[model samples]
Target chain A: MTIHHHPGKERIDAVRAFNRFYTRQIGLLEEGLLKSDFSLTEARVLYELAHRDGLTATDLGRDLGLDAGYLSRLLKKFEERDLVERATIEADARRSSIALTKAGRQAFAPLNQGSHEQVATLLERLSAAEQDRLVRAMQTVQRLLGGSAEPKIPYMLRSLQVGDIGWIIHRQGLLYAQEYGWDETYEALVAEILGAFVKSFDPKWEHSWIAEREGEVVGSVFVVHQSDAVAKLRLLYVEPSARGLGIGRRLVEECIGFARTKGYRTLTLWTNDVLTSARRIYEAAGFKLTDEERHHSFGKDLVGQNWNLEL
Target chain B: MTIHHHPGKERIDAVRAFNRFYTRQIGLLEEGLLKSDFSLTEARVLYELAHRDGLTATDLGRDLGLDAGYLSRLLKKFEERDLVERATIEADARRSSIALTKAGRQAFAPLNQGSHEQVATLLERLSAAEQDRLVRAMQTVQRLLGGSAEPKIPYMLRSLQVGDIGWIIHRQGLLYAQEYGWDETYEALVAEILGAFVKSFDPKWEHSWIAEREGEVVGSVFVVHQSDAVAKLRLLYVEPSARGLGIGRRLVEECIGFARTKGYRTLTLWTNDVLTSARRIYEAAGFKLTDEERHHSFGKDLVGQNWNLEL
Candidate 1:
């Protein structure tokens, strides 16, 4: 519990351990990367030059977070090796643009190819699905640590697969418990609903969607057959880590589309008013509050509300 | 196909992108980490000193992969700041042991605590399950890239959970296809087996154990009722990344233990000769090959073998 409010030493060590592990994994611990003659920093500098158009020493230092003196020294080494060429900028007399020379590109190509091969070798051991999982996990860590901005990776939706139900049950149970002090019953309710849905799954009338970003499941929603004319929207939830990406709204929209495609006259859902974020999403999806009742569930006194959207 | 033979530019770019993403995530691009006055390198040096005892300047330079001149200058700065005290070694006049002073520890404590809190905040958004997934994913990347040796992390076995079935099927299907050129029919067979197991799971007679290292599922085995007196071991596998970790051996042992505890007279399994790694583990665990049949399946000629262990 002490680790709850504050991270325990164990968690900190885990991060540090990962850092050490990755350093070795990437061969940063070695004198040179991928058995190349250039040091890790040198390879990084070479990479920047090989990829970017033209950069001044200041730009390189700033972008790479390198000290001015150290960067200058490294650049000098590259220059002496004929791996880089510096030309004075026409518009800026004080600045010179740095670029990879033919020799530089030649030196860099093998290193780049080696890195690619190394990563590919790592990935080849895994199945395609696991490769995706690995990439997504890396992206998750990057996103969580506030690093994913260059491409701003988008989320994708796919039909629910075999394991999603169990994950949903487990996540919903723990999430509700952590956020609202809900008990095990909420998780049991989820399992029961999902179990029945799977047991009596009608491909013609029922469908589910799971939202993923960088290969991580961020949200989910389900539509189940209720009657010939109506469909029930159930178990709509988005992960807190992926909350503001509009995944909740998107999930609702998908539900609505599927319900309409299946010729349902109305889509209805039951939820607690305590879930304000979900409420906002529901309300925005044009679901009207049709009923409200006081209920004690999940060990909390709550107002249960039913909403409906006419197709 | 070109990517398989030789990694494409995209794969190389993915690694570079991840590197960029991670650099930003860890605040290595910042002038000072966590808004502190220490550069990333300086903080790393401080961390090393605080964690270890009597490390000489040479040790720090070698371990950190820092240039001798750079390290000396940095140490000089620390000495001027009253942050580090160095003493000449008793036996060697040329070697000086570096130790952090009280002021250095004071400066480092907040930085260390800051890093811990940052990682904590990132993990807090995830449910425990998701957190475990993230950690495990990281460990997988590290292990695949040849890290994870400091503590030699061990694997553990746990009861099967909801999402595990899907993962097992997905991994098995893809792994077989990749490694043995087996087709989707193999995947379908795994799915059928897993589906039937879940649909008619008997807690008293059937049990599955998932092997996890750093929260990543590395291997699995199931002991299911072949008869009242016999238990069938199904879907025994260890990920290629997790091979040589003895997880396969452990999983087989776990099955043996469970079958004995359940009062089954024998534990048996059907496997292919192509699975030489698994065959070794079974043999090591005292399993005797009792049957073999040459079969044409999964797009290749193969020999199937059945092995059993007496309780």
Candidate 2:
């Protein structure tokens, strides 16, 4: 009896062909959208500005991966067209905020409409299940490609707003509980950390930011005052969904920058030995493992670790 | 007992930082190599010309993913520099072959040496085992990324060559033997197919191509005579290592172009039901299942499948 071998290669080839067809189709669609109203660069800038309502030119450069000089020239062009307005921030005279004009919004509305229509048309070709599969495939591609891009340390640092601290405590507590058995002591430690962060809040001396992508908050960190000589790095948490994009490194760099500007000579943070990711970020930011101690307090005993960087 | 969870989030962060570091390092190394003797674009053109040896401006455009017009300009620049020479093929005035000059070889050697040195330097930073792991990881990344690029149908077609037929048989035999428990009968079928391909070769009516990437042959296929009203596609095979890059689709497109030029109204092929990959290539190239048959042959009971495409 001859066993029929499965046609695995054929199925893979079909999928490969579909991928090629889909990419080409999408390229054509994007080109069509571009020809109608905007050049690719202008459209990208519009998309970035629309998503980030008030970003500095420097911030736009970082976010969009544009050269600073080129971006500056583009911004000048946009300003000349009266599509975007730039003004010095009253709070910080050196920094400028960029906001779209009424005409820009009017242009953006139609562009957004056309984009949505194009996406809908493409999605319409696939069955509901196929659309789901395509979206999942796109997410996989994004993860794979995004994983390859260099992680950057974001220059802009803001303060921890409402819901940010709560998220950190909740996520960390849950992850820790899941990994190590649910421990009251671990939860208590997290609460204490949260309380300390909230109690010492100083918008002028301290700051935090939730790193965002596609309108969703993915990671965050905070810089808080310790003394005139030093500042404490606190609540550095990156969500699992956003782990590979270099958000943690950016968060750590934000803390370092805040410390540097606020006249701190040293930066310090406490973590556990098991938290290798945090340790790596600290080390990459020029921190050295100055000291470490092992202690058992929670139901699941683990060694606690501390790391520091001299800014 | 508490299960210690692996630090997935942390590892991801470290990996991201490492990627940033590696890309920047590599970019700097490449720039250093360029500053000494050649511009970046010149180095790339030389590298491509060196590796391909006899590729035309058109072939370079397709392989390097450059625009034909742009590639033509670059080739003109290389010709002006006396680094490359282009000559019309003896049989066809329309076809041109490009070859690198002695100066091109001299320029390419140091660039290649610098690249090797850079790789060595990177490897030196890691332990021997880490170096091996890094190479393996890079292979995986290249495979995944290279496979994801969309395939295109080339506008020009070239006739079948000896290497093309050899690869087709070797790949088909290996893949069939591994995937199905085919024996000498399958080998016999392959031999017969090759013999028929060689016997029926016509420069004006038939075409074949050996799909290449990074100086390696990875796939091949053929178009041959059938009847006054029909043309037969044959020996379509992509090596296992290059299976996912849509090489089969390009080969089929070449065959289709040949068929159209030769005034054939229909194209067809025969295969076993187990050859799913070929089936997919046919389907994606706008073919449909036209016939199916089952027969016990070569000491094993198996069913054969036939498919066709209308021009």
Candidate 3:
């Protein structure tokens, strides 16, 4: 049961407007759906079967919101066309389970292929940036509509995976180039740092954390042994798209906790003064600026700062 | 005509999967539409009538993809209930235009409100950040689905409006606090600077540019007179959501162009070393660092750098 809210007139109108526009847009695509031989309902039924096995006609009808009689007739037509086959649900012999036949899979393959082609054609026209914006916007709608984008503990911090090192280097390189105009030298620096971290073999004294969401890596950080009693935090990074979720802070906190648990006396990190956002997080997490120097790196004259936290 | 592309099988499945998810979500809401008193089609007809000004039965049937006889009978029922009125289309005197009667509007009010409430209820469960993500995702979908989110000139530079200065201050304040963890003093500084700008206004050499997208202000920058021969750029800020789009660079360029066109010999701006992103744009646009000073501002130890571009 849903509790109701009295939304203002303008809010109601805006939503209705969105609905109208979306309906029209979907109608335009309805023409191209599943190569037009199959109606949208028929295509959808085929799609459900293609994606899942052992769904009963009752389940499909309930899921599709089709009338019982309408679904029965549609399934009958599908059976006649040899696109679907039914078998007894082993647990309840009285109930029948629905699955697409080999012919049904073949039929759906074209429709599926056509839909993908359609979306690809749609997306190809956009720049990569626009595609990102579109995808992000879609995520927003889904989230706001009580769909997938929930904010509760969005991403989990896990141990680094095999492919993560390369991904981190590539992302750091690309992102620095795009966001800060740091050139190929930045990428080179990232590669060198990550390479060095991976080349070292010490599981007891060093640890790495990778922030993952929806099977995607969003951030990473490493704590390495600088001395027997000191751990160095290195290669801290968060995806620009995933930034405001406190991933950087969490990663830094993870570093601090690991350093403490490993009996390190102090944790130290080096960063450019220009990276203010990261610096702010460090400052908040009890890291004090210990030293500063002017240097040339990544194709720019930069101010470097060292921060340390007493464990 | 759309050109066909043979996307990979995995990509096709992904699109189909999203379609299935979205269709099911929409289907979940279809139940709430008519209160079991009317079918989805009937409610949709009422919706169209409630939102739109006028439509003939033929037009409504065409728009709804309804069978002619079915729509005719539906209209007859509505007329019997005094829910709709018809009048001649004037130029096409033989045809009729349909408009909702007072009774129609009254009857539709609760349904409209219910739908609005439904969406609100869906959204109310999400965190604000999740809501932002959801809305952004929806925009993305609309853009990709050939709905809205057009890519032509995402933002336009215009003179500041009545509420823009306040909006700029509030936004800059809120954004800096959120992104950089700047304190209330930073917002106070913005207010003071803007207040000063408003007090000593010059319409000739000094100018302000507000970047507007979809009728909302996304960025702002201003040129103020430091001397008769030099123009100072001030308050250069862009909304984080709108950042990555070169608005800052364009705004700076606009300042340079305006300063030169207005016969100023040079343009200057003061920023911090920590503002690396802005600094890069300044460097790219031929601004040379002239001076640096250690200062305490925005409740932090900051390096203030002065940049000047010679016209």
Taking all chains together, each candidate's TM-score versus the true structure is: 0.66, 0.35, 0.57
Considering lDDT, where higher is better, how would the candidates rank from best to worst? 1, 3, 2
The residue-by-residue lDDT of candidate 2 on A1-311, one tens digit each, is 11122223333333333333333333454565655567655776786777677799888777556688999999888899889998889998877999889888778778766765555554444333333334433443333324333235322344444334434545565566666564534544554455455554576777777776543356777777878787888768776545656779988887888789888899988777787888888888998776777777656556767677887
How well is each residue in A64-101 modelled by candidate 1, as lDDT tens digits?
Answer: 77789999899998899988989999999998999999
Tell me, what's the RMSD of every candidate? 7.4, 24.6, 13.3
The candidate with the higher TM-score, 2 or 3, is 3
Model 2 chain A — which ten-residue stretch has the worst lDDT? A1-10
Number of the top-ranking candidate, with TM-score as the measure: 1
lDDT (10s digit) by residue, model 2, range B185-253? 454455445544554456666666767754345677767777877888876776554555567888888
C-alpha RMSD over true interface residues, model 3: 14.5
Q: List ranges where model 2 is wrong by over 4 Å.
A: A1-37, A109-311, B1-54, B62-68, B102-311
Q: Ten residues in a row with the worst lDDT in model 3 chain B?
A: B1-10
Give model 1's DockQ, 2 decimals: 0.17
Name model 3 segments beyond 4 Å from true.
A1-16, A33-37, A67-70, A117-128, A143-154, A158-311, B1-15, B34-36, B57-70, B143-154, B158-253, B261-310
Give fnat, all candidates.
0.12, 0.00, 0.14
lDDT of 3 by residue, B1-311 (tens): 12233444544445545556567676766778757466677778898887677688888878877789999899889889998888888889877888889998888788777877787776566544344445545544655666444557788989854445556756776677676676546655665566556546688978899999766678999999989899999989887657777899999999999998999999999998988888999999999999999998766888999999999
Provide the overall lDDT of each model, using Cα atoms, as 2-decimal numbers.
0.77, 0.61, 0.75
Please give the interface root mean square deviation for model 1, in Å. Answer: 6.9
Best by lDDT: 1
lDDT tens digits by residue: candidate 1, B46-147: 989999999999998887778899999999999999999999899999999999999999999998877666667666655454465567666666654553
Q: Rank the candidates by TM-score, best first.
A: 1, 3, 2
Across all candidates, the chain A TM-score values are 0.69, 0.49, 0.60
Error of 1 at B212 (Å): 1.9
